[model samples]
Target: MTSTAIPSAPRRSTFAQPIMAGLVTALVGYTSSFAVVLTGLRAVGATDAQAASGLFALTIALAICAVGLAWFTKRPITTAWSTPGAALLAGAAAVNFGWNEAVGAFIMTGVLIAATGAIPWLGRTLAAIPVPLAQAMLAGVLLKLCLAPFVALSTIPLHVAPVIVVWLLFLRFSPRWAVPAAMAAALGIAGFSMGRADAAGVMGQLLPSLEFTAPAFSLAAFTAITLPLFVVTMASQNVPGVAVLASFNYETPWRASMLATGLGSSAAAFLGGHAINLAAISAALAAGDEAGEDRSRRWIAAVSSGGFYILLGLASAAITALATASPEGLLEAAAGLALLATLGSSASSALSDPSSRMSSLVAFLIAGSGLSFAGIGGAFWALVAGLTLRLLIERKRH
Candidate 1:
């Protein structure tokens, strides 16, 4: 008897899985922390329009960087706006300089990032910085923002409680989407607050427009903004981003990644974006098994995510308008909830090393204090103090 050969099951399209992964990566990354970016830009002397422009510029620039890097390297390399750096900006004290000076600081930060890749000694110097202290500084920078959720709940429970509850539900069942869900709920409240007369005007301006500001350098802005932004982006975002990719058995092209992000940051600076760097948390979405079983094809996810980011960038005006118009404490509460996980992780890492615990604590306290001296912000001082204390302690021990 002859047995008929069985036909194999039809193969699924190879592109669909990775494309969906890319879409989720872009959606989650953009929705999660954009409020924080807007708040950070506004904190550093940006007007509402300039803040919106900054957000748009950052989205487009980083999206391009991600697309280029992934396409050229054939790796799932992703770039993102510096979320930790943005937190540093949001927590920064009032500087004596204006928006122009802040723009100069941003340019300087981009130059420094590029230098880190081109100059071996500079990257080494940044690498030599103790991890615990760096994390402590980040934790300190995030403290006020992380506390905002409780502050909002205490003051505006009627408007804020529902958002918090939704965040909690998602956090328990779907942690990755928690912040985005809360942000959506917060936007709903903000939309309800807007009058119909203003809705048409807001709708008409949904497409974003860039606002350029020429750089005006100042020592105060450099000390308060540039130094902290560079250090934070490198330590918290870029370094961790590379490590994350490595964990998935992919080697990122370091110099290329840095140059791409640095140039992107510089190009976007004129339009108010503070900085862009390698993505840490969101990088996994595009680089991991979720993208596809074939490691060779995962780069498609990164490239696709970049396309989605461009689409999202077009909606910046609408997002900024809604967030800025939200009831007092509402959007801030969403931002705070978004940062809570980072704060916890940073705080934990800062205190994990027994030998450096005190120094790390010092850094954390100073950063959280909002102190300013000689027109310099607390973040700068926190690093100095932590390093000095660590050095002195090491000397005594020896």
Candidate 2:
């Protein structure tokens, strides 16, 4: 009898490289977007405690979804609270609804998102949004945040310059680490500038706590906030997120992913979070070769990122405190640096198709205008204008 040697599985790197990749991915994602989340919460009348709880809830829910989905799908599917949705919430606050009503709106938005997965036509319609228009809307939504660094330089040059310098210098060698380095520098400068007593006060009570805001559904919320939030989350966040995965040739389980995001958002909304959806920029970090040389092992990067997210969620109080302790524009600067690549990519994608150029520009400009009408943000209107213009333009050609 001839003995045949069994094939061994590919050996994963025993070094901390994969873990580092995950850690960086998690840190970047959390730091880059957490500031916006906080601002949105505060805008919607959340007390500091409530805002902290929202961050904690969102992070934990997304962490669980990321870990579970990545493990099940064998793909790197990073989940996040919708950044644009948060921005919309911030703007929607102008309508002066109480936080409870906002939570109700969040619940409604999550239901709509979940319904898309359960309802075929709805999902197809959402999925069918023209890529250029969606990309344009996202670019518009990001423009404000991406301009933070410039704003910071103007407002707090002394603090921001060194951070920017560090980022630029590091970008030449370690592109991934540049943003994190800048963030660390910002935090360091902020801490020192704040004085020891203030810094200590900021670090007070480092524990995870849940704060529930009961839902108060209203027709106004449904039309003004919920619908727009759902649309932006779908078009600007989840759709682009899924596209990133597909671009890398990952056959994602779209239905399952959407269902998971909707459930996570619903659960987190009760605990003060707004929405949780697929991550676009950070997903690329975890799914690509940067995660690992071997595609099969990249899931570990996402799992590690999820674990770190949970830990960060547990320390939400400290995180919020630190963010609050920073100089007014410092967090924005750091976040802008983190989003620079994403904004550039989205802009390029939006204008790449010559046929969609005019319509895409219209969407981009409107969304970037930061206008709000009837509690709906520029993003929604931008989409509407873009679609209308595209229709009119294309009809003439035909």
Candidate 3:
């Protein structure tokens, strides 16, 4: 009998690649964290500073996952806190009770997530779901975000249209430079507009200051914040996160990753933060070619991301200075453009599968529609739809 040969895995080049990726991921958080923080803070009625603290806490927690795993495995494993957690809280805060109650929801949700990690069934169940379906759902979930730049133009046509045009042209021509180039162009234009127009509340150098609010527990906040958040996270973020890891052929223990994230967020919540989880989207940046040429050292990039994020979390004031340093308009445009690729990729991939494609398509629509029930997010709705279709279709075939 002829012996079959097993393929040898590639060797990693250096730790520098993962280190740089980690740092860049942290650097992105410096400015971007404000968006999530503001939304979550307002949801719970925390002071702006408290919201910043929440973001700071989230960042610190994420760093812990990246660093902890790297130290243990000696392979850089990257992780991040939830960006969508802030988004989830924003709506939950607005519709639900007070901020203290929202914090209670945060704590409740984190505990549930941690518990979910401890159970082997959770991993098996989530794993049974098709990677393609999950990926598609994620892309669909972000469809609107991809279209945001263009749609945003209608709201402020005069100021933003030029950059949109330039960005569109660049995207049409260069393809690769589309996202970053659009980013630079948009920020440049927003800055120019802000300088000329001088929008008062949103402009000028804003200083970071400290403030505190006591947290109170409430069932309403917990239902709105905790339940919906966990579902969205499990479906939208972690499902796709695992898919991305699969794409890269980097296999870290899923249960271990979840446990780490849960513990990290559990600690972060006491200080004031929403949730922490593996880095799904940002991990792609470093784990992909953007981090470096050496493939095996991808974990190193994740480790780097964690360390730098911790530094940012520690120097909360410094993070604020740089973000508020730019014109708010610039921040908005820069953010929109910078995030476009992630949005587009998610939307595109969600539709990639042909079999049960409609099921996933329905999932995408439900999830991306931003419709909520019981304070749960669109991600849950999409998964529900996808699963429903999967079950019905399978049953009919039998």
Candidate 3 residues lying further than 4 Å off, grouped into runs, are 1-21, 28-47, 84-94, 128-145, 162-228, 235-250, 284-301, 314-339, 353-355, 370-386
Q: Give the residue spans of candidate 1 off by over 4 A.
A: 1-13
* Alpha carbon deviation, residue 15, candidate 3 (Å): 6.6
Backbone collisions counted per model: 0, 0, 11
Which residue runs does candidate 2 get wrong by more than 4 Å?
Answer: 1-21, 87-93, 195-197, 247-249, 288-298
Candidate 1 residue-wise lDDT, 1-398, digit = tens? 99999999987559988899999999999999999998888888999899999999999999999999999999999889998888899887465678899999999999999988888899999999999899999999999999998998789898899999999999999999999999899999888877885577678779899999999998889889998899999999999999999999999998999888998999999999999999999999999999999899999999999999999999999999888777887877888899998999999999998889999999999999998888899999999999999999954764
What is the Cα-based lDDT of residue 152 in candidate 2? 83
TM-score on alpha carbons, each prediction: 0.97, 0.86, 0.71
- List, residue by residue over 83-197, the lDDT tens digit for candidate 2: 8777666555556468888889888888888888889999888767787787787788778877888988888999889999999998999876787788778878887888687
Cα deviation of 215 in candidate 3 (Å)? Answer: 4.6
Residue 180, model 2: lDDT of 74
Q: lDDT, candidate 1, residue 77?
A: 96
- lDDT score for residue 330 of model 3: 40
* Candidate 3 weakest lDDT stretch, 10 residues: 201-210
Clashing pairs in 2: none
Error of 2 at 395 (Å): 3.0
